[model samples]
Target chain A: MMHLLKIEWLKIKNYKAFLFISLFFLIGIFATNYIVYSVFHNIVNKSDAALLLSNFNPYDFEHVWQTVSYTSGYLLMLPSLLLIILVTNEYTFRTNRQNIIDGSSREEYANVKMMMALIVAATSTLFVVLTALAFAYSSEKDFSITGFSHVGYFFLKALSYNIIAIFISTLIKRTGFAIGIFFIYMGAENIIAQFLDVLSMKLKSSKNIDFGSLGDYLPMNSSDGLLSFPPTPLKSFTTSSLPTEYTWIVLGFAIFYLVLFSWLSRRLIIKKDL
Target chain B: MNVLSINNISKNYGKVTALQNVSFSVPRGSVFGILGPNGSGKTTLLGIIMDVLKATGGTYKLFDENPDNQLRKRIGTLLETPNFYHYLSAVQNLKITAGIKQRGENDIERVLEIVSLTNRKNSTFSTYSLGMKQRLAIAAALLGDPEVLVLDEPTNGLDPVGIAEIRELIKLLASQGKTIIMASHMLDEVEKVCSHVAILKYGELITFGNVDEIFINDDIVEVASSNIDQLKDALNLMPGNLKVEIKGNIVQITFPVGSANLENVNQFCFEKGIVLSQLQIRKKSLESKFMELTN
Candidate 1:
């Protein structure tokens, strides 16, 4: 098993796609910091200094980690699109056919590809963390940021999202089709969660639904995840604060889809002639 | 024992039949040729043997065991053109293929040399010519140093020189006592290298035998004589392994299969004063014989 994994790794190591992904997220973290500082720094000049950033440093380790991990959307689509392109191109390129002819099981081939995508995901995640930390210290002299939770949360969230993306892309070889489905599913869940919360607020009792657990809906029902929730509902929208359970739900779905795609891709091996 | 054997294997694509009750065995260390025209289930059979496609019926055995287990390490194949990662260099592409096969070594160099692509090893796969790509495909097949080689249309699109190069490589491999099963539409090539041959037509085995058995037959003796009538009359009187005919002052006689008594026949004709002008022995080529069988 290790031998095969190594082989798969070697095959994917030189792919231009992998290189592009790693670079995209690394550069994105720095870009996000520049944009945020440029837009908000001047506005804070007339405001209370403590309320702004304590004026000591906004570029502490904690803040850097947050920016890097919190802003990994650029990499969210990497795993899905990359895995799909790798798998689907086998049909058009005919190389996969050659693989089968030389005595490789389809399962072995799929396993290698999924493993590579996951590795890329992990690499991107780590790069975001490292890049954030690199800038955090250089930007600050007197203080250091604390609390790994925010940036950690960001990493886990992106990782989960990327895993599921890879799963969907592997099962459906077409890039556009898988991404379209992803958008629709995410969009529908957000809409339904909001609508249900609104209807509950206007009821005779007017009690909000406690989607307090992870099974049905997400916290603030958004992919970015919520660090804070507003006290008042400007609209007839109110719900119990999201439980950490929603994270688990999202994570579980990601795992389930990964396993499912893995199984399906493996089974497809014996179905066709090379 | 046979090196590769498929027993009563069948595969169907919806209503279309890809293979039907197909069974054949390749003996150890022999150049076994599976001869067939396009779409005659040759590739399907090779696919099943390699486990690329599942069989709808029957079982197969390789190297004295079910192919699912031991055959992978035992067999190497170049089934078609190629499906390599074009952006990667030749060495890089091979590294990936070798990795999946699970017996990683530096045979990438050995195989590149075998294919005469050692000078171009660093070049990307996209830069390879069609023949170079095919050679690299075969190089991939040789990666594991397997005991058996299975190739389908190995020279499908190569120029004559490239085809000849591949043929030489195949012959060299065979000389090392490796069992080789090659499926091809080129009858002349099969005749040149294959000791044993199986002819498939429309998903059925038309014939299977040693090369000599399939090709060995009576040789034609063409005789253009001064007097065709006299030669025919003299030949008609002859006995033992002879069939004589007369057409336009030429008396043609065909001898029994495997009989080499042409000198005896010539002496007899001279003694009879037939005055032979032209005499030539005609051996039937595999192509002509194939046309006879398939038609």
Candidate 2:
């Protein structure tokens, strides 16, 4: 597996897009957290809302992990886009066939790509951890690991997005088309999840029944649902009427989808002609 | 020992069959040619053997063992076209190929020099001309100097000089006791380089064996006269003529290989009181023989 990964590294080590996207993603993590960090530091601190908030600093050590993970989660799509381009580039260049012709088994080829996805997710998660630590230390608060689980959720979300990117790349086998479909699917899923969330709210209010959030049961949303804005006076005001958060069930669904997509991507490469 | 043994291999694309029950074995140390026209499933068959495409039915073995990645690493192959990372230089691309083959990482420079691309090895693959890209693919396939080579249209995009160079290179490699399986539509190319040949037409294997046996070099004599009928009759009665037939404005006589004598043909027509307008001996071209087999 390590030997296979070395070969994979050789393929992308000189790729301009790989380096460019990686640079943008690293900066995007810090820039996104900085933007959110400033909003609370500048406006919320001086505005009339500060009295109701009672001096809440989201970037403080207590909440920095959740804040950074949730804020950085939106930029997860960048790495996923990178993964899509890398995988689909093999098909675009027809090197996938060449790789196998050079003596790579279909299993080895597919396994290496999956390993790439895992490595990308791990590295992105590591960047998120670093960004959280940077913001937490700068807040001048005592160090704490209280809300670190949000970073773990961020890793799952990263892996979920990346595996889906690889799956779509294998199925679509074109760079622009796979990237387009990925964003389109994300948009379509969000709209449908919104409708389902509204329906779940209605069910809870009128029928006195609880199904948790049906929107969180979806593939992307299950992982997305794992991370949320940390509990605050402002956020609590809007949570009274929302459906209960079934963390365990949503976490289970997220894991199930990961395994399902991994298996599916592997099967497609193994059983089909290159 | 046989290098490759294919058993009843077949491939189908929906209702269209690309290969039908094709079976052949390539002996070691022989230059084997898979001769066929375009769209004749040559690339598809190689693809199946290299495990890039799934066989719809049947199986194949390499080096007298079940095919696997390890077995494939022993045979270098360039199938169909030049496939490489466009953004990478020729040297970089070869590195990836060598890395996959696991035995050619240190031999990149030597292979590039063999293909005469050593000077431009630093240029990106996308910047190469069609001929150069083809050369780079050949260079990659030559990495590690594998004992067997499967080249599909190996000279497809080369200039005349480049083509000649590759042909000479192939002969040189074969002289070194390497087994080469070449897929080409160029009959003359096969005739010049191959010791064994397999002819395929529309996905069916027509004939395969020693090149000498499959392509019997029968001699032909063409004679035309003022009276075509008299020319045909005289050739029929003449001795040593294997077969005689009338073509447009000419009478063609077939004879055993190297037995067609133009002087005898001309003399026979004159003795029959017919003045011959044209009498010429024609060597049986491999193209016509290939057409005869495929058609």
Candidate 3:
């Protein structure tokens, strides 16, 4: 597996898009968290609305993990988009076939791409951790690992996104079509999830029923629902009426979808003609 | 030992059968050719052997063992077209191939030189012309000095000179006792380099064996005389002739392959009191034989 990864590195080491996308993703993580940190420091702290929160700092050690994780989660698409391009580029160049011709088994070829997805997810999680630590340190609130599980959730979300990228790339070998379908699927799932979330809220209020957030049951949303903005005083005021957050169910669904996509991606490569 | 043994391999794309029950074995050190017309499943068969395309049914063995990736690592192949990362230079691309094969890391330069792409080694694959791309693919196949080579249309896009060079290269490789399985629609190319051939038409194996046996040309003796009917009658009386016919201004006698004797024909003509204006033997062309088989 290490040898396979070394070969994968050799393939992308000189690729310009790989360099550009990876650099962009790393910078985007830091820059995005910095922007959120500034908004809290400059505008929110100095404004008259500060009284509503009573001087609460979301960047404090306890909250920074969740805050940074949620803020950086929006930029998870960058890495996912990078993964889509990388996997689809193999098809575009037809190197996937060439690799097998050279010596790689169909299993190795598929496994390497999934390994890549895991590695990308890990690296992205590492960057999110660094960003969270930086913002947490600047708050001068004494280091704490509280809410650190959000970073773990962020890793799951990243893995979920990256694996889906690979799955879509395998299903749709064309680069343009795969990327287009990925975005379209994400958009469609989000819209449906929003409608389901609204329905779940109505069911909880009118019929005394609670199935957590029905929206979070979706493949993409299961992982997305795990991370949320750090609770502020204003948000806490409106949270009492909302349905309970079924963390275990959402996590379970997220893991299930991850395994499902990984298996499907491998099956596509193994069963189909290149 | 047989370098490759394929048994009843079948592939179907939905309702369309691409290859059906194709079976052949490539002997070690033999330059084998898979001959077929367009859309005749030459590439499809090679793809299945290289494991890039799965056969819908049946199985194959490499090196007389059940086929696997390790066995495949011992063979070098160029199938369909040159596939490489357009963004990387030739050296960079070959490095990736070497890494995968796990034995050619240091042989890149020598292989590139073999294909005469040394100067363009630093150029990206996208910058290469059609001929250069084909050459690069050949170079990749030559890496690791694999004993068995599977080439599908190895000279598909070469110029006349490039074609000649590749033919020499293949002959050179064959002289080194490397088994090469080449797929080509060009009958002359196969006739020139292949020691064994399997001719396919409409997803069926028409014939396969030693190049000499499968493409055996019948001996044709053409004789023209002032009296064409007399010449035809005289040749028809010949016991060893397969057929004797008057064609235009001459009489053509067909004999079994390698059985035509010009001296006997001349003596018999003189004894029959017929003066021959022209006497020559024509070896049947492989093109016509291929046409006869495929059409």
Candidate 4:
């Protein structure tokens, strides 16, 4: 596995687009976090900071991990796009065929892409941890490791997004079309999830026919459910706090989607001619 | 032992047949050529053997075992144009290939030197010309020092000098006891480097045999006289003539190898009262041999 990752690293280590996209992802996440942190640093008081900032907290130590993890979720698309470009570039350049001819198996090729996703996810997660720690030290909030589990969820969510992107890229083979489809799927899945949510609500209102949160089981929405902005504004609207049990359920759904996308990508790579 | 064996492989792209029931094998230490014209299923056959393209129906074996990644690792291949990350340098690209082949990185320099690309090893692949790209692809194929090398149109887009360089490199590799399966539409290229050849036309194997055997030395007797029609008639009267034709004032007679010499043809023409003005023996070329087979 490490050998395969090393091979994958060699292919992209000096690639300009890969380097730029990765650096963009790293800086994009940190810069966004910094801008949001600085914008609210002076406006919100300590007591209301938790409510106003919600999950964007760079100051508080107790919930800083969750804050950084939740805030970094917005930047997942950067790495996802990066993965899409990397995979689709192989098709564009026809190096995927060369790779197999040079002796790498289709399974190895697909596994290398999955390893790349893991590495990208790990890198993003590392940034989140580092940003959280730096903010905690600067703010001097009670340094507790209480909400660290959210970091784990953040990593899994990031991996799931990248896996899905890779799956789409492998299936589509064209960079522009793959990315276009990815964005379309991203938009369409949210609409479908919302439609399901609304339908379930209407059925309950009209006939008291209760169907549990089936929309949350969606592939994309399930990962989104893994972490969310603290709902200070929507407390009165509904579901003020995400239950621990619900987070676990979403984690299960996230894992399921991750495996499904990975399996499908492998199947496509192994079965399809480059 | 056979270095590679392809058994009744067939491939179809929807309605277009890319390859139909093609079967051939490369003996160990022999320079084999898959000779064919453009779109003659040479690349398709090589692709199927390398596992880059799937066959519609067939099976192949490498070194007497089913082909897997492990078996493929023992055979280096270059298919079609040189496919590498254009942004990466030759050394970098080769490093990736070495990693894929599970070979030592130190082998990179040796292969680079073998392909004569050591000076430009650090140049990005996009910066290299078509010839350089092809040489670098050969270098990548030589990385692991595999026993077999499968090359598909290695000189397809090269200049005369580039073609000569690749031909020499292939000869050098073959001299080192590497089994080379090269595909080319250029009959002379195959004639120069291939010990054995298989000719394909329209996805069908038309002929397969030893190159020397296939290109037998049929004696070409070029006979001309003051009366060309009389010389032709005299050559026709002669027994054991394979073909007789008149071009301009010369009546060319073809005879089977070792059957007729220049003296015998000259004596026959003189006995028939047609004294030869020009008489020469020319050996038939592989080009003509290929044209005959393909036609």
* Top lDDT model: 2
Best candidate according to DockQ: 2
| Backbone clashes in model 4, listed as residue pairs | none
DockQ of each: 0.44, 0.89, 0.87, 0.76
True contacts kept of each: 0.70, 0.91, 0.93, 0.88
Model 2 bad stretches (over 4 Å): B266-277
How do the predictions measure up, each by TM-score? 0.78, 0.98, 0.97, 0.90
Second chain alone, TM-score for each candidate: 0.88, 0.96, 0.95, 0.94
| Model 4 residue B288 CA deviation in Å | 2.0
Instruction: Give candidate 3 regions above 4 Å deviation.
Output: B225-230, B273-278
Model 4 C-alpha lDDT per residue in residues B1-295, reported as the tens digit of each score: 8888888999999999999998888899999999988899999898888888899998998998889988888888889989999889998998888888888478988888877899999998889987889888888888878889989888866788878988998999899988999999988889899999999999999988798788887878887878877777777888863699998878778888756688877787778887777889888887888889888
Ranking by DockQ: 2, 3, 4, 1
lDDT of each structure?
0.69, 0.93, 0.92, 0.84
Docking class of 3: high
Model 1 Cα displacement at A114 (Å)? 2.4
Q: Candidate 2 DockQ score?
A: 0.89
Residue by residue across A123-171, what tens digits does model 3's lDDT show?
9999988988887887768999989999999999999999999999999
Better candidate number, 3 or 4, judged by lDDT: 3
lDDT for each residue of candidate 2 in A65-148, tens digit (9 for 90 to 100): 898898999999999999999999999999999999999999999999999999999999999999989888887799998889
Residue runs of model 4 more than 4 Å from their true location after superposition: A44-62, A137-141, A212-214, A240-249, B222-233, B245-251, B275-280
